[model samples]
Target: MEVKKAIIPVAGLGTRFLPATKSMPKEMLPIIDKPVIHFVVEEALASGIDDIIFVTGRSKRSIEDYFDGSPELEMHLKQHKKHDLLEKVQDIASLADIHYIRQKEPKGLGDAILRAEKHVGDEPFAVLLGDDIVVNEQPCTRQLIDIYQKYGRSTIAVKEVPKEKISSYGIIKGKPLDHSLYVLEDIVEKPDVDKAPSNIGAIGRYVFTPEIFNCIKETSSGVGNEIQLTDGIRNLNRSQKVYGYKFNGTRYDTGDKVEYVKAIINFALNNENMKDNILEYLQDVLASKNNA
Candidate 1:
């Protein structure tokens, strides 16, 4: 079956971002010109997902409004003859068939996804975490969808992180099926580096069969007193086969301050309007730092 629906969990309290996120959602923070969630939605749209279910919490109204039509702003832009900017704004509102649901509580990723059970029905669907932005010729979610189509089972995107950073991710031990493809044998959530099964860590992109909802329900709360999605996926794997694909992409964890800054600089460096100026500015900064 074609995966036409996606669930994005954006209910997290952006504690890391503190005062900046106190009044605004971290997902609404801009990378360069566009907000983080904008890129996520664009990825889903590019990956053939037309239906988007966002599991939101309090203070997330801005997210909904960002994607909704702004008549006043549209009129102003149109009157100013800013056709290019007006078209972009119009495109965002009509980007997809978007729906919102509240998590009600600060549950983990598993619970955030479970809120979409009714909307997703019994079909296979994709889950894209709003915090991670992946750049590639092929969308990351689409890569996992392609794997699910071939295997007829659940699939998750994986990438090799450095061993030192293993504990920060859900590490997976898989039996190699093909180059960059593996039949997942085990998955551990945030294990110590010395105890980690492998360096391959699961990223935020997932394509799951409906059976995962049941597994999540059966899963008990683990780390941080919240139901972990990694645990749910591990349980689901026990009942049925699950595959992991080492996706080809550059993934930015925008939730981290350093990574968020890196994403901004990297994106700006590639942007046509900002590339030359940013390049010269960065060169001067580097030169100044060296002289100091």
Candidate 2:
């Protein structure tokens, strides 16, 4: 089966980013020249996803506008003979067939995904958390999708985190199918370090079957009286095979301040147009710090 649609839950309040996110969606925050969400959307598009369902919230109109056409800007650029820049602006609008719906309340990732039930219908779809940016030789979502196609089961992207950080993410306990794949036996949401099942922490990329919606619907509120997608995936394990693929990639959690800065620096240092200038600037800054 060809997986064609994806759901992006972008409605979080981004409390970690505070005043900067006060009037802006964290996904709208620029990594350098592009918003964080742009990278996510580009990943999805590159991975053969054709339709994007954005589960959004209030004050996120800018997100919609970013992908929508910019007539005035395009006209000004065209008039100024900045054809390259004008085409770039025009390209955003043609990237993918995008649709948006309100998440209504900031429930949880499960609830946010649930909002896409109608749009997703009976097909297998993906859920890409707005804050995770997976940089891989192959797209992270596609990696999971390939696993899904081979095994005919839902798949989640997993990567090892520090043992002490297990409590910060959903930890999976599983038997190894291979060095990089695990047949997930269970998932524990934010367990104490001593009690954690494994160091395999679940990240944001998931390729779920329609049956997942059933699991999500049946799942009751969990900790903090919220619907957790992790809980739903755990429940899905009861009747179906769920696998975790420790994907080949480096993932950046943009929701964290330090990681966000690191991601930008990493990208800038590798970017063709910005590498030399950014490297020289960084060298000077470090030189000054050492002198001080």
Candidate 3:
């Protein structure tokens, strides 16, 4: 009940990052210097969720000008005094309370989260998928918003994917109530490793339960014809119970170009100003490929 709105959905047309997302908006593609949707809106503002709701489309206006408010790059960093880079560009326009809508075409992701059903009316929201980054020390959307605030229902953030990548996602099958929880009965979308139903996939975080916008307006189109948020969470798990936690961790699908160059070499080897010059430039490119 306290999930103060989220719903990222950045209206995908990335076409697997073609032509540099042909005019930018692949969540403003970046990793080493922030902009994989700014670490997914800083993991929904570090999980207290300050009401975001992006759901955009059509070349995404440079993700609404990278969280707006630059004011001539803050008067050219205050006329070059650069007050610590103008307080980090005025703290990305005061970080939260953002809002956008669009989604007029490129349909999928359940019609871009049904364009935030009138700014998430019935609440209990949170979606997060800006091509997933999930680096977690507890903010994989706050570990499914703390299992949807101790079991009030719709939660999902699953992991364990390797049955040949379980046909690339939405797999859940459920039963175990706690070794990292799961209650779902079934959710298939993308299944095929001989009709998958178990290698537990479902990623890009979620929390749902605005009765999932009437189960995504009674889901219909699927597999590329679109409207498939895992078939509207399998019609909100046939009227109620749906859960899946498994989260703890290191997602980074970054819309894959080999996982976006391994999330830019794991965020430039955990950047403390580029970790020892990227670990001595990755040990001189692995000792010049082991002496060629």
- Which rank order by lDDT, best down to worst? 1, 2, 3
lDDT (C-alpha, whole model) for all candidates? 0.95, 0.93, 0.86
Candidate 1 vs candidate 3, TM-score winner:
1
Instruction: Please count the clashing residue pairs in each candidate, in the order shown.
Output: 0, 0, 0
- What TM-scores do the predictions have? 0.98, 0.97, 0.34
Candidate 2 lDDT tens digits, 20-72: 99999999888998899999999999889999999999978999999999989
For model 2, state the Cα shift of residue 102 in Å.
0.7
lDDT of 1 by residue, 248-269 (tens): 8999999989999999999999
Considering every candidate listed, which one attains the maximal TM-score?
Answer: 1
Off by over 4 Å in 2: none
Candidate 1 whole-model C-alpha lDDT, 0 to 1: 0.95
User: 150 in model 1: Cα distance from truth in Å?
Assistant: 0.5
Candidate 1 is scored at a TM of 0.98
Clashing pairs in 1: none
Order of quality (TM-score): 1, 2, 3
